[model samples]
Target: MDKQNSRFRWVVFFSVLFTYLLMSSQRTAPGLITEQVMKDFDVTATTIGLLTSMQFFVYTSLQIPMGILADRFGPNFFLIIGAIVTGVGTIIYSLGTHEFVLFFARILTGIGDATIWVNLVLILGQWFKVKEFVRLIGFAGMTGSLGFLLATVPFSAWIDLLGWRAAFFSAGIALCLTGILLYIVLVKKPRQLFHNESVPVKDEIQPQNVRMLLKRIVSNRQAWALFFCHFGVVGVYVGFISSWAVPMG
Candidate 1:
């Protein structure tokens, strides 16, 4: 039984990792096909800039709302729903002719991508204790890094052979299927896994009721300092890479 349980946990971990890979692929798809998009839409660099910019805009704006939904409705629910929405958006993007449609599709994809990191973190917190947190998160980060690595080379190869639309179509299908699987396989808490163990009954944690929690978190000086440090470091790194790397290529 212990072996079976361990196997089950590993399966769940890999499934979540696969979902993250798909999310990363979707996020980077536009960058992979920037030249094709520019030619097909007959757009200037500025327009392409704006379309991609919308992705970041939507992702940043939706973070808080996605967190709330994940906490209130459960991460699996929102993550799966987000994946479906993202897959639909990718399909629409592949079929899109006009710039407006493309922009809309990008926005949807961004919203979908926004659900991934937060929900995964929340899920990890539920499954692993504090002692295991760093190691598990490191493993998750490695998965994300692998996804990014795949996006650059393997993804480009697929786009070259199949064309961007076909590539996106395949990706969309994968995301949709994975989302369904996650919804079916994922349980909200550890107690849900034990057949004989009595389930703990607790009040549903509402987003609105989280104001006090938020207040406590925000009032922590260390938290504020950590937030700014992360924001400054990550922001600078991502911004520099996003702006400079493609141009250098």
Candidate 2:
């Protein structure tokens, strides 16, 4: 039984890691194929800039709301839905030939990407104890970083060989399939899935009330500091990296 339990934990870890990598790949696809995007759309630098900005703009703006939704409806559901949406967006992006269609595609992708980090954190929290949160989060971060690393060089090569649209379509299919698999395999609450386990009562768990939680998060100085820290670091890195291929192409 102990060995089985240990195996189950490993399964959960790898499953989550694979899902995260898929999500990261989808998010970084645009960066890898920005040149193709410009050629296909026949757009100028300014337009491409706007479109790229739209990805981050929508994602950053919607994150708070996405987090709220993830809390109220379990991360598993949100993660699955987000992956589906992202897949659809990728399809749309592949089909787009015009600026408007591309804009819409980016928007959809942004919305889909917004749910990723929050949902991942939510899922991790359920599996790991609070004391282990930072370490687990760091591990997840490393996995995501590995995904990004792969996206930068190898994904670019794939774009060159496969053509951008084909690559996007392939990635979309992979993400959709992974999302379906995760939905089937993952349980948001262990107790809910394993009846023998003693689950904490509702009141014992943190409140799921969105407004109250937001109020607390917003009021906390440390939270704001952390938010800005994340924003600054991720924002600058993503911005530069997303635009790198554009000029090269």
Candidate 3:
């Protein structure tokens, strides 16, 4: 990366960082709005459970396909589309009347959110050195956690003042703007400047490679071991935080 592009890498990082902030809000928003959702939708725990689960269901299911799309079309494609779809879905969620519509909105939001984390991983790979990747991810995790923190009291205050619809509506608009920021700042398959410039050239990212990637991942014993651990920890943890935590509150 030249000086201009080097500066823009941080810009790209922050853009994705901000996108993660809103993505966290979307993930945790249902928890915060449990009571409001229950009252407004006039539904019981089961409906709310299903509604909340809808997002995660789509989110989890789309990971492979999303990963393939990101690699094939470029991470920028997913990043841009993800933000746009998420924003639109959030707006729909805020405006939704019926349970079914809300369900689809949540699912759509999940699809959009699904594109994000993986795309960020790809972006980190494109911009930073391999050794720096983990640290950048750690920082990204911290930034995302900030959104979770905001989703608590500050978000509650927004709902208290504006009501859930207006609050979510505003967030949706912000998400859309974030998408535009991504379009402006994020370069598609940017040259790996954070790494050794003399590193050998590599094949282009392509759709066919996705199959090999999956095969490699599945064949790795350590990957399976870590998969089980992540499944038990992250899956349960996210499910609870994204769904049950607010109602518990």
RMSD per candidate (Å) reads 3.6, 3.2, 3.8
lDDT digits (tens) for residues 29-86 of candidate 1: 5677777888898998888778877877898888888888777777877878878888
True-vs-predicted CA distance for residue 205, candidate 1, Å: 6.5
lDDT of 1: 0.75
* Candidate 2 residue-wise lDDT, 1-249, digit = tens: 221243465566678788778777666668776666677778787887787788778888988888777767778888778877777887888888788998898888888878788988887777666766778789888988887776777787777888888888888888788777777667543434565655548724564677787799899999999889878997778776766543254
Q: Candidates ranked by TM-score, best first?
A: 3, 2, 1
Q: How far is candidate 2 from the true structure (C-alpha RMSD, Å)?
A: 3.2
Model 2 residue 62 lDDT? 89
lDDT of 3 by residue, 1-249 (tens): 442247656767778888998987888786888877888889998998888889988988999888777777788888888998999999999999999889989988998999888999888777666667778899988877787777877888888889999999999999999888787677433444444444345635534666787899999999999899879986787667766676333
When 1 and 3 are scored with lDDT, the better candidate is 3
The per-model lDDT (C-alpha) reads: 0.75, 0.75, 0.81
Poorest 10 consecutive residues by lDDT, candidate 1 = 240-249
| True-vs-predicted CA distance for residue 214, candidate 1, Å | 3.4
